[model samples]
Target: MEILTGSHERAVTTMALDGRLDALEAGQLRGILSETIERGDVNIAIDLSAVDFVDSAGLAALVKGMKDARQAGGDVKLVAPKSADAMRVFELTRFDRVFEMASELSSLVEKW
Candidate 1:
């Protein structure tokens, strides 16, 4: 997966992810999220629109990041994936209810 992260003026970290988010890439995502939180950038907006696939490991990594961010008094918001197949994972896992999601990254960024 390719991850492009940037810091916004509102102190939110915006990350745009592309490619498959599977076991091989989950660890990388987890590590980057950890580093971002460690640096006190706990409010993260992850744009998953370009991601074509997701698996269990990817879901776990995202959940972990959300929990850690919430604990730090911030939160992790997701920009819903455009792919119905990719979004099915979140729906089936009931993560759609657990996460705060938006259809557009710009919408989420505005709120943050």
Candidate 2:
């Protein structure tokens, strides 16, 4: 997996993930989110539109990030996954209702 990071004026950290988000990449993603929050940028926009797949470990990492960010007085907004398989994971797990999601990154960033 490839992770690209960027920042917004609203103190939101944007992370775009390319490729599959699975077990092997879960730890890395968790660490990145932790570091971003540690740096005081707790509002995060995670663009999953480019991601091809997402497994349970990947979802766990995202949940951890969301929880940590919320506790830090911010939130983690997800850019709705373009892949049906990835989207299904969120739906099946009922995480779609738990997270604030948008189809576009710009939309989430604007909300932040």
Candidate 3:
């Protein structure tokens, strides 16, 4: 998988995750997000649009990233996801509220 980094609303650091986000890759994902947070980013957005799969470990990584960001007065959000099954995980965990799920970059920009 590859991470495409960009900026949204000028300040929000957006990381677009691609490929699988299962146990095998969750650690990498966590590391990337953690590094992003450590870089002093206060606003982060993860674009899961290109991610084809997500497992519980991946979800936990996302949660961990969110927690880390929040601890530093930052926030992490998830962009719109096309995988219905994976999306269910967010709803079940109430992460739908924890992370701002946007339909597109514009949706998030409008809110920001």
Candidate 4:
């Protein structure tokens, strides 16, 4: 998987993910989020539009990232999970309620 970074008007940063989010890639995702938070960028939006699949490890990474962000006085939101499988993972895990989701990056960035 490939993770790309972008910034918004506020201090919010976006991580656009491409490819599958599986066990191996999940660790990379965690590392990226941890590094971002360590740099004092707590408000993060994960753009999962390009992600076609996600497993339990991927979900755990997201959950951990969200927890760390919240503890840093910020949050992590999901943006445009267009894939049915990706959306299903969130829905089945009930992460849709835990993390704020938006149809677009602009909508999520506006929240910060």
Candidate 5:
């Protein structure tokens, strides 16, 4: 899995998540996101359009990222999920509300 990260603006950072996100890969993403958020980022947009799969661990990592960001006085938003499996997980977990779900990366970043 490749988690490509870059800043689109001073306040917004984008992570293009690709490949599978499960227990084995979740930790890598977790570390990357935590670092990015901790570095004074106010808005985050995760481009999951390249993600092929996501499991419970992946969901947990995302939740942790969101929680950490909000707790830091910021916010994290999820762009449209590419994998149907990931979509199902989000829907089943009712994360559609916990995280501001957006169909496009631009919309998510524009919110803040």
Candidate 6:
């Protein structure tokens, strides 16, 4: 998986993810989020539009990132997950309820 980071005016850091989010990539996700949080960028938007697949470990990594962000007085939001298989994982895990989701980055930025 590849993670690209950028910031918005609302102090929201957007991480655009590409490729599969599996066990091997889970740690990279965590590290990216950790670095963002440590930089005092607590509000995050994860752009999963390019992510075709995600496994249990990837979900765990997302959960961990959200928890860490919240603890820092911020939050993590999911955006534009176009893959059906990837969305199914979130649905099956009921993570759809746990994390705030948006169809576009603009919506999340506006809400935040």
Q: What count of clashes does model 3 give?
A: 0
Off by more than 4 A, model 6:
none
Angstrom error at residue 71, model 5: 0.6
In lDDT terms, which candidate is top?
Answer: 1
Better TM-score candidate (3, 4): 4
| Cα lDDT of model 3 by residue, 1-112, tens digit | 7888887656889888888888999999899888889999868888888777778899999999999999999788778678887687788878888787887866775566
- What's the TM-score of each model vs. the native? 0.98, 0.98, 0.89, 0.96, 0.91, 0.96
Once fitted onto the true fold, the runs of candidate 3 whose alpha carbons sit more than 4 angstroms away are none
Residue-by-residue lDDT tens digits, candidate 4, 52-95: 99898999999999999999999999985798987888899888
Give one clash count per candidate, in the order shown: 0, 0, 0, 0, 0, 0
- TM-score-wise, the better of 4 and 5 is 4
- Residue pair clashes in candidate 2: none
Task: Tell me how far the alpha carbon of residue 83 in candidate 5 is from the true structure, in angstroms, after superposition.
Answer: 2.6
Q: Compose the digit string of candidate 1's lDDT tens values, residues 1-112.
A: 8999998988999999999999999999999999999999999999999999999999999999999999999999999999998898999999999999999998998998
Task: Please write out the lDDT profile of model 6 over residues 1-112, one tens digit for every residue.
Answer: 7899999998899889988999999999998889889989999999998899999999999999999999999999998579998888999989999999988888988899
Give the CA lDDT, 0 to 100, for residue 62 in model 5: 91
Candidate 5 lDDT, 1-112, residue by residue in tens: 8888878764788888888888999999899888887778757788887777788999999999998988888777888686787688788888877888788888777776
Worst 10 residues of 5 by lDDT: 3-12
| Candidate 4 residue 55 C-alpha distance from true site, Å | 0.8
Steric clash pairs (candidate 3): none
TM-score of the candidate numbered 6? 0.96
lDDT (10s digit) by residue, model 2, range 36-57: 9989999999999999899999
Whichever of 1 and 6 has more TM-score, that candidate is 1
Which runs of model 2 end up more than 4 angstroms from their true locations? none
